[model samples]
Target: MLAIDETAAARAMIQISRVAKTYRTTDGEIPSLRPIDLSIADGEFVVVVGPSGCGKTTLLRMIAGLMPPSEGEIRVGDRIVTSPHSDVGIVFQSALLLPWRTVLANVMMPVEVKGLPREIYQPRAEALLKMAGLGGFETKHPWQLSGGMQQRVAICRALVHDPKILLMDEPFGALDAMTRERMNAELQRIQRETKKTALLITHSIPEAVFLADRIVVLSERPGAIAAIYTVDLPRPRQLDVLGMPEFVRLTTTIRAHFNAQLD
Candidate 1:
């Protein structure tokens, strides 16, 4: 049996029980994820890392209630996730901001979708943008912002609705190395301040170690939980943490898993 951290399970805000996924195609059934279980504590930061086809995104989508699992169930704070609920916000690789909309407008998109009162959420959107360091760019369009800035806008948009949980899928994959590192720092800070439970999917080991409270590893296709490691490092971690013995050790251990798979 896959063991879950007892402390986390006891107070889990997100409980994924035996969740699995298989796609039915004209050719045949394609197994995307094997039976998997995980418990994410309220306000925790969990990062999932694995090979390209390891079903990491599939797990994320299921949690977001974007798709149903082939088997098992997922719950958020005692409520079963049958569909996309208001308590969750999602960020993707692309910013996906509307070209016609200004930065502030893009951030308010969730409010529009949910039919929330503009008077109530408009200020919240502006506040989130300001928190993301785009305070003066509220009137600017997506085309005018740098890649990192656009992603920051995306993050602000995801939070404007005040979701309790945040789900991100390879959010920094499109950035150059330096910018990606900086975004990692920014994301960590934002999560800290907002206190939202987060689950981010990424292929970068260093990124995973830097951002996660716990890191979950998945196997290749028909992905199963290969391992889960508690970060055990201090919070408000800086980039220099990458050079720390514990950080290097954790990243090396995670990297070794993939290397063994290739062997």
Candidate 2:
């Protein structure tokens, strides 16, 4: 068993038990993800980084129950994740906002889909907008916003539903360097406030270092746990912290794995 921290005050939000995946292609069986055992403590933020096509998103899909693992089980709380559940919110690379809907309505999409009363959630939607720096843009359409702003709406939509777990699949991968950095800070602030248990997968080592409490790095294709690094940096992390020795050391360690694989 992987050693989980005993200092945690709450139960783990997600648990993976020797999980693995393989796909049957017309050509032959293809291996995707190798055995993975992980524990994400309640309200903790974890990130996964690996080479592209290394089964990073595959790991996330299995955890989210969007796709089933060929072996082993994933448990969210006491329930086995056989299918996607309401308690999980997902964000992908694309903002996926409705162009026709105003920012406010877009944020309310999940609430509406769940058949919850808008009156009860409208205030929350507004508050999320304010927190995302989109307060004044609430009435504007998605086209009026910049890439970062549109993603901010997507983040608000994810949180407006109040899901216990937030799963992100490189939600900022499309942005330029400057925008991505700003989004990272924005995400860190929002996550600190909400304290939702979050697991995100990205290819960027720096991003993984910036937002994660623990970062799990996967090996090449048929991804398996290569290493897991605990980010002991102080909370409410500022952008300037990236220049520190510890931050550089951590990123370097993770990069070494990929660098070695490429050579």
Off by over 4 Å in 1: 1-10
lDDT of 2 by residue, 1-263 (tens): 23445433227789888999998999898899998999898889999998888888988888788999999999898789998887788888999999999999999999998999888899999999999999899899999999999988998998998989989999999999999999999999998898899999888889999999999999998989999999999988899989989999999999999999999
Which candidate number maximizes lDDT?
A: 1
Model 2 earns a TM-score of 0.95
Among these predictions, the greatest TM-score belongs to 1
10 residues in a row with least lDDT, candidate 2: 1-10
Cα lDDT computed for each candidate against the true fold = 0.94, 0.91
lDDT of 2 at 212: 95
